[model samples]
Target: MAWNLDSQRPIYAQIIERVQYDIVSGHYNPGDKLPSVRELACEASVNPNTMQKALSELEQSGLVYSQRTTGRFITKDTSCIRKIREELAKQQVLEMIRRMKQLGFTKEETLTLMDKIYEEATYEHTIGV
Candidate 1:
């Protein structure tokens, strides 16, 4: 999880976003145990307190749950995971659309790009590329 701390957002917020991305991308699947706070802090080269804050936010959002003695685990709700995935997908698509608009891409050009991307994705899957 290489993070760009230079972004305008706070470090903890970036950490939270990265973790959420991991969850949505299936890197941390439902019910999977996450690294300990200290471990994750070291891995991310961030302060333990920052990592804890990020984890706390995730727990509050119900994306992760803690066991009294076991540790934090990714939520076991498939629907929650799907919802997160959809929400993130929508956000990314919106951002791309906004950028394309700013760059003077017409609606037709945007649709053409989308179709090209879809075709490439399908072709890659079919050819195992």
Candidate 2:
């Protein structure tokens, strides 16, 4: 995994987001083992403590669980994965809406754009594009 350290967000927060994205994207599937904090920190060139904190936050969020000696693994619950996906989708939509508002888009225009997006996404899914 590559770290974009120059991003506006804090490194730890970006690390958490990257891990979450990996989970959601199936790069780290349910019940799959995750790299140790030290390993991940080395890979990302981040502090071990920061990586640990991010993993701890994931544990707190129920996206991952720790087992004695075996280390941490992704959650096996499908509902938990679905919940994470829903929450991420809601966050992305809220951010997009906020940006639109800042750009002076009217509510009706935002809704129309969202409808168009939905149609495009549906078409993409239908055509496997």
Candidate 3:
């Protein structure tokens, strides 16, 4: 995970978002064991306690779970992961629209431009660009 902390939010919350993005983007697979708290702390350059707090929140969100005498793993619930992925995608799209509106684009213009860009990207992907 590329950890970047912003002044706008808590470090642990940023950590949680990074982990969630990793899981949804397949950087971390379902049932995969995450790095130890100390390891993740080193990776994110934060204190161990902060990483632990972020992991605890992930557990509460059903994105991860810890086993006795073992360690934490990404949840095996594919449905939950899929739901989260869709939610994040929608958030991205809405943000894009919001920015375009602030730049004076109408709703139809924003969506049409989005569709055109997606089609071009899809074509490139299909051709192994």
- For all candidates in order, the CA lDDT equals 0.89, 0.90, 0.90
Clashing pairs in 2: none
Query: Model 1 over residues 30-51: C-alpha lDDT tens digits?
Result: 9999999999998988889999
TM-score of each: 0.85, 0.84, 0.88
lDDT of 2 by residue, 32-71 (tens): 9999999999999999998999999999999999999999
Give the Å error, residue 55, model 2: 0.5
Clashes of each: 0, 0, 0
lDDT of 3 by residue, 1-129 (tens): 447788688999989888989999999999999999999999888889989999999999999999987999999999999988998899898888889989999988987887898789888895344
Runs in model 1 lying further than 4 Å from the true structure: 1-4, 120-129
Superposed by TM-score, candidate 3 places the C-alpha of residue 45 at a distance from the truth, in angstroms, of 0.4
* Candidate number that wins on TM-score, 1 or 2: 1
Ten-residue stretch with the least lDDT total in model 1: 1-10
Candidates, ranked, TM-score: 3, 1, 2
Angstrom error of the Cα, residue 87, model 1: value is: 1.1
Model 2 lDDT, full chain set: 0.90
> Candidate 2, which segments miss by more than 4 Å at Cα?
117-129
Candidates' RMSD to native: 2.7, 2.8, 2.5
